[model samples]
Target: MKDAKLSNVFAYQNITHKDVFLSQKKYLSLFLNTIMNLESLKQLFLYHGCDKIYVKILSANDNSKNQVYLSGSYDVLNIFPISEIVADSSGDWKKERFKASVKFSWITDEGKITDAPNSQFILYPKYPEVRFSGFLQKSHNAPSELMSKRLPGRLLFMSVSNSGKILGYVSSPESEVTQSFNSLKHLEVAGVFKVLELELKINYRELLLKELFRIHSLGWITSKRLHKSGNILPCVSSNCGGYTLEAELGISANGYSEPDYLGYEIKQFKANSFDRIANEVITLMTPEPTGGIYVDKGVGNFIKSYGYEDKSGKEDRLNIGGIHKSGVRQPLTGLTLQLIGFDTETFKIRNASGSISLIDGNGNEASSWSFTSLIKHWNKKHNQACYVPSKSVKVPLQKYLYGNKVLLGNGTDFQLFLKQMLLGNIYYDPGIKMEFVSSSKPVIKRRSQFRIKSGNLTNLYKQSEIVDLLKI
Candidate 1:
């Protein structure tokens, strides 16, 4: 039974009758499929027009269970460059920012052309659970229905030089499909889309290269696609479909100042067609410990993984914040507040909300009140002048004033919270240093942080008063 199971893993279905003296072997096929260097990429680039091209293979994975699987994606992204690449935005001196809508084209080995779309790109670390089958067992074989319906996709990246003279390409597994019911489920789901398939019906490589050529002709520097990597072998056992070859590659960014540049790593595999009665596509995957090759279903338990949740089309809550005067009924200015986690406990706010309200002890009902209303209420009740104290005063009012005069998003969130005052838009007309103070003060006398010829508030005297009042 064990030998029979082992035979299934390495089974090779015959395409045509041929007599061979040697017995079936799996390792022989795998050894022939693997490509360990970057020479191929360099060759592809030179073939197009590049004077010189650098190529490096980082890592790779391969698996076989009656079919082959390979996948790949590109490394181009609109990101903040390592050395700030700046451009004059119609007299606006904006810092380095990402530009959208860069397009590219690709050409295939057989002269086919294809279009490459543009969008955001991100590189993530690979997990360790990818597995592969060493040998197969009939009892362990995937169900016939599931095996018949599988369709796996391969991935690759092909690039051309900036001069439009050279082309480069790398291919690996993007992902795969497995199980008849599950595969059907994917097709049945409405509003769902499946990419163009490259398999039995089509000469996968020829189609892939043709698309690459299409992208190249369209002026795209490169094209990326998925493909299975392995050669077919003769069938050795009964009830065999054909030889299935699998290959996986691990690509990692080179440790350059630019974190975006990555090098490719490739692995190749070859196994008999009849090793197992599995389908063309292997959907569910299990990681093998040896390297990157992953095993499809017909194994054991599956685990859930966590990642970004889909919150598309969800409404966002309306929240606002700003600086408020001590006694003013109306807010001087207001801006929307962006929320972020501070510590595990409470939220640390860098700016005060423009509006204030008194809430019940239970934190339910809120009675709206403004700074001017509060001051009027206080003055009416006390019949004495109510002042929002400066830092010079040793009282709760002074603490409140200190906390209110804050400059946020100036280097760091915590720094703004600790330092109450902020100098706004230094590039524009140097304005007054906004500070927390009591009401009834003339706006013209507001102290200016940047020196300018103007009103008292903008004058040196008011500026001195502001510095003295804030104790800064």
Candidate 2:
């Protein structure tokens, strides 16, 4: 007798047609009808140790009237059992069959392991015959039904069986289907999916171009409108053009878990404008220093020693700003921003004399981060960032309206940024602003700013990916 356990076939050699001996004419006919499909036949062959098999349907009345089907060398088919017989019909020993849901597993040419559930099939005890039944037709519209259940990746194939029950359903995975399902789920929870499938499929440069086209389609958006309701406007920010391209690209207004649009940060500014970036300076994030002379001195003592009088009429403020070139003294604090632990002439960072360290009001030393740490943080926040340039036109009744023409910056070079900072193309402009109330002690606010020329932005980034907004 053939091995009853289907899994055992994988260990043995090929089995012939005679090996699949079935009894009873009704059972034989049912088995033949079910294995008519290639999928079902492939499953049967895989389980029966047959590289090549010929299935013959024998009639109980006449063996000469039997039919046959052949399956060629079967290395491409992969079949695996999912479940065992759960329950069976009551005590009728003469007629009984076991049912199971099967699963298919295969490794793609790309080496990706894909496993999916197949439909139900029956195993008869009287014979080595198994009947494959297609999935029940839950609905006539396959896409609509699968979409409703958020299983868009599942491809369902349905047909009416001889008994009129819907037969056959197979699910195939497509990246687009998965993306659509994820997008739909995001929309349901967050009320929006920031990027469409087309947007996600393209490269970062193409995505930026698409966003520029979308912005241009808006025609002219006024600065006043953009500033007053900047969150809703297509422009960046009223003060500096913050949300322009990002808003146009349908990104969430607030900073959250992910990047602005399709894993890329969108930064927009006017073309040829001196002050393109909204913030005058960029802050490099770092952990607080644990132990040092500065830490022992504390914030109050450090300020007392290095603090300079402010021209704004405040009692005393330690304001550090302006361009501090390598080996040159800063105008205000007479200190230079230097790279530590490396040679300045050859490396991006170098240590300098009289480097000032900061301490918070809570007496904790504010640690300075290395260029590597800063670059890592920046790249994490913006794996890909697009810098867009726009043209502004003045209007009589309305505020300035931006033109459709826009330029895009492809990618950023963190090493180049560090080099620029060392070369004085970027400057450290730290400041402290004090606010006083009726009877309360003055509120001291500190800020760390690294300023750079708006025109020098191109030097900090790689080649541009320019796309005409008017032409899309």
Candidate 3:
């Protein structure tokens, strides 16, 4: 009768005697809370037209603990056709009340409604006081090692809040789980609200790392951004500062130097690898994150799309160079190698000079420069690879060879030059199948292209070419 549109009715079904009866007590309390209050009371009675209504009793351990839970079905019976119940002077109210009479019955041992209770109240509509109990559990915890990234392993816990918020969390050397069954075991004797894992103040970063370390057995990645002032924050750089490996959260390998990484100084780390440095920077900073680190997928794609000289109608912008031992020259302009998906092929020599090349199965070429006579004479004495091919194909003996071309160069090699191109490293399992198309062409087709999407360097957790490391 309150507001038909806003009000909802609940009905009970699945009345099985086998089910535990104690669970229904909570539902009964919730319903009373909604509809029982004196300020909103309304009631009416009838004698003749009311049909029979039935109530069932279930067995509890003791009669004092007994109760019947009412749902929306009771609302329909208690407050329908409100006009019939209002005590107006008009005779229509009296006539309507008489029309609403109903017979009452109770279920007995034989499961039949044998009789009704003797007393029944006939009255004007009014509400009653609603009383209920059993609120949820809320707790919090605090961690001391939040500022320092030095956890031995992962931890997990479960927590509940006074406002009925329940959270299951994991704290690892990376991320942690807090306030669950496992965490509860250690604090069983503590008061209802004082459990450590259930407490909410624990350092979530350490918690997550603890969980990650439990699973990975390695440390979580600790990347830091070096700001201008050089003050090391627990999180990554907020401004234009570059990223540095705070510590090897988990990854380890042979000969890998565990250098003390002071966060990125944009000036010192100008290499293209800075983009990945930014991504790991943001992931560690935000909690309950909405989005991810902004990356120029299109820029990488654009370079891949327009960057090379492809007979297949698409060019590879990032290419590897190949300089041959015989000193045969290839023109530098349209001569970039296809390195995007190559595995066995890698960059061996990225020299101090701007000229760059690849070392695939096909012989190498000084793919960025044009030949000069001084370079041709110089290559014979130095025992280096062939010189860069001339702009236009010319006599064989006059062609320039490597190591001498940079000595007589008129200007610095083009940063955007095809030879000084960036390289995209593609790593795969050792058994990955790959084949060279031809000596003249630098294309290696893999057995499957499915691995390409995930093989991008950005998706890679760590990257280093065999060329980047020192010989030691």
Judge candidate 3 at residue 329 and give its lDDT: 30
Q: In candidate 1, how many Å is residue 142 off?
A: 29
Better of 1 and 2 by TM-score: 2
lDDT of each residue in 174-205, candidate 2, tens digit only: 54323333334332110111211210012445
Candidate 3 C-alpha error for residue 84, in Å: 96
By TM-score, the better pick of 2 and 3 is 2
Residue-level lDDT of model 1, residues 138-250, one tens digit each, is 32222222223333332223334424322223233231211211233232111111222111112322322232233223331111221222222332222111111010011
- Candidate with the greatest lDDT versus the true structure: 2
RMSD, one per candidate, in order = 32.4, 24.0, 32.6
| Residue 426, model 3: Cα distance from true site in angstroms | 3.5
Off by over 4 Å in 1: 1-107, 110-160, 163-168, 171-332, 336-472
lDDT scores in order = 0.21, 0.39, 0.21
